[model samples]
Target: MKKRQRKVRLIRAAIQLVFFIVAPALFSTAFAGVKSIFQAIAAGQPVTWNSFLDVTGALLLITVLFGRHFCGYACAFGSLGDAMYELTLFIRQKVFHKKGRHGYPEKVVRCLQKVKYILLAFILLSIFTGWYANLQGMSPWDVFSMLTARKLPNASYKIGIILLVLILIGMCTQERFFCQFLCPMGAVFALMPILPSALFKRDRSKCPAKCGLCKKRCPAHLDIDGDTPLSGECICCHACEATCPRKNIQIGQEVEELKEEAAVSKTPVKREKSAAVSK
Candidate 1:
């Protein structure tokens, strides 16, 4: 509940809202622009310097430094997924009195998570094979774009609807299911080289026994007690820091301050020689 934390939450909310409401209308660019770039490269086109200034490039640079924060805070489909899942949760609780959200088995979920890599490879291969246009209809983000434009689909409409429905169901039952297991763009971000300038981190030394609140809050299901909080799957949402009851979790400069304190305390203070001993 610190002022800065509250500000961060507000900013996150505002970004999510903008993506949800204005992005489709204003930017008109689907969040899958990154995947399109890879497809273009697979087609043997020369990469241009201006390409580095596009949305995908900006997002790539951001992910390189800060992790997949864009997915958590600025993705339109991600915001929709969060809203749909929350609405489903409310309905399940109030209508069905459900206490638990169900999803694919953990083993199955892990296996499915690898499918994004396969999809990425398939897209690249299809581009090289000149079948990219035929398979592009299968993209959920393209479907998202079609839906955004309020245009009726020509052919692959049924497939698009089915995929969208499945995505909705997955979102309802599991947190960030698309980002975790299906987003090709997210796969790229997850593979990017990690920088040391990450924000979210935990002080496990200060954690109380039996406290796993951070784990419950983590949308990515990362083991927050590990040596570093900057996991490949991490979205840099800072939910762990916000949920920690012990207040041991730190982000940004707070982490540096804690390290400084630890270092200062560890430096031993030499005791002055007693006057009697000197005599």
Candidate 2:
């Protein structure tokens, strides 16, 4: 299982590199195409609306069907964050002899989670108000474009550099920090619940008692300890499933036992007279 997980990660890394770096370099306008559509809509321009549909519509459909697998698997910016995080861990352990990894406190993380929603709201507001440029300076996609292509924005964007540095530090210290707390794009996907069932799930019946490994490995710190899978927060990263020692976790959802429990609870309990009373 470990070997299989490793192979999956390697393949994912290759795909991210090729699609993000190689594909964009080879084809002009490959990067930031989606952003352009949003900008066009915000500006009320006579834009090639079909191109927008071609890109983001597909992603939105996939998000609805499978959850945010795009973020976990295909997003170039996500891959960059993961790389920064791993490099930070390597440096910390090898140089400082740190025995364990730590993330933001649960309280802090929860508070931070709300930020993404706020950001999403703000982005929507900007779009409706035709103020898309409000986010232009520090847009992560634009920063990625500048970094990859060695092209400067038409105007100076100091905030973009500053935000990029902060993102690197955040990723290094906390797994998927930006995705969890600040990515408006990710927020859009997360708002839409996946159809039928999430693409992956945990079997609590088979899960070992007292094993919190899945929660610890989860980038979103989702509550996988429950009787049924809680997947709204899940990013489809499979980190939790991979780290499970029992290998009980699997891809695809199972009908929750909770439904049966609910049904049983709804039936009234029968009361029988005591035999002593009858005698």
Candidate 3:
């Protein structure tokens, strides 16, 4: 617990320094975004809507640099999902004495997991149409502001109840029911088209018995060993690498030695076949 707390504190300090102190833009990056929107409105010109570009750029910057560390380290929803996972583990171990029946086939689970990406598209469409304009009452940001300011016509008891219920359901589900099954942000990060991006790739040859322990640890339900997993389903949680006893996994650095060894192995086999043919 101390180690976890220490690591979290160090990471928090880094975030405070980089985001709050040195570059607030590093965190929000919402400066130019809000500016452009308001500027366009002031000029009475058509505003380029959809700041997904900014969000995508930020995601890529973080992903290429840190290998999905944003999800593991910074994202609020991801952090909440991880907390829920811990809660679920506790409930199963202490309260119930066993896990929920590992329901459904692996293939079915993987298939159903694709729903998140589709839902992400729906969110984008809804945003454009202002489908959630009514949700201002339910917004957490609004609630906090209202509470702090101590003035509101409707404080939204219903919204508070709804949020709590959702959070509870998310906590109790089999696996990140909210993050894995619902979060559009998560879906986007997982499905980021460009992949590998000069990051640390798995050394398939280094595994004893070529055991796929890394794949087993993946909460995003990715085959970290079988494929270069840059899918929309992958959260880059690093649970797989963390579970590796051999420390064979890496994040943003490639295993060039392994690549060279693989190349040498292939060359020797080809050379042996050539020599046999000559003989």
Candidate 4:
């Protein structure tokens, strides 16, 4: 199980690294496309297709089918947050000889998560009201994108640089701080209608009493046990599946099929034993 967990983490990390280097601007591009659509509407202009729209549309289609795998394994900003959090843990354990907490308190984190939705609404409002043009150099994602592309941000991007630094600081203190509580793009992903086939399902009957490993391991702090269908906040990271001691968690269809197969397998064995006893 430990080996399996390590393998999973390694595979995700490799994919993240590749995407971070190869297509770091994907989120920014897709978001720009969304803004453009509304900006055109506000201007009473016809919305036309473009490369940005193509990117956004493709990502939305993928999200509807596969949950937020892009956030978990492909988003450069999310990968950066994961790196910062891991670096913080390394510093605490190796340098200060102190263990890091898993995350912030669940209640506080849940409340903070709501802020992203508000941020998303404000952004859309700014775009529609034509105020977004005035705020051109204020986006931290723009700064991050510039840095990743090996280009220096101009003097106009000073505020953006500052905001990026602050977000990185937040990432060091909490895992996925920007992703869970601040990213407008993350808010959009969380609201997407993901298919059940892509969701991780837990068998409560198989879970030991009082066991909360899955919830504890979740970066989003989702209430997997209490939430019947699980929250859309799930990024499809599979941390819960990897951490379960009893291996009781599986994809929705997988859990059902496994149980059916187990029942069928036991029936044949039971029938053979009864025949031997009667003979």
Give per-residue lDDT, candidate 1, residue 272: 34
Q: lDDT: which is higher, 3 or 4?
A: 4
Q: Judged by lDDT, which candidate is best?
A: 4
List CA RMSD, all candidates: 5.8, 8.4, 8.0, 3.0
For TM-score, candidate 1 versus 2, the one ahead is 1
Off by over 4 Å in 1: 1-11, 25-42, 49-53, 100-109, 225-230, 253-279
Tens-place lDDT digits, model 4, residues 1-279: 788778878888999999999999999988888888898898999999999999889888888888888889999999999999988988888989987455789888888999999999999998888888888899999999899999999999989999999999999988889989998888888888877777777656667899888888888777554234437788778788888888777765555565675567679999999999999
- Taken over the whole model, the C-alpha lDDT of each candidate is 0.68, 0.69, 0.55, 0.84
lDDT of 2 by residue, 119-205 (tens): 877777777687766666766556667777877665457777778778878888888888788877777677766775555655566
Instruction: Decide which is better by TM-score, 1 or 3.
Output: 1
TM-score of 2: 0.77
Clashes of each: 0, 0, 3, 0
Ranking by TM-score: 4, 1, 2, 3
In candidate 2, where is summed lDDT lowest over 10 consecutive residues? 23-32
Stretches of candidate 3 exceeding 4 Å from the true structure = 1-57, 99-105, 134-164, 194-200, 225-232, 253-256, 259-279
- In candidate 2 the C-alpha lDDT for residue 259 amounts to 38
Per-residue lDDT tens digits for candidate 3, residues 1-279, read: 345435644664455334333332222233234334544555577888667348656766676554566655555444545556667777677887985322234565576677767976664554555564454465432342344345552745568446645755654654555566655556655665534542445676667795766665566556653236435455555556566666566654466765676677789899999999999
Tell me the lDDT of model 1 at 256: 55
Candidate 2 residue 243 C-alpha distance from true site, Å: 1.0
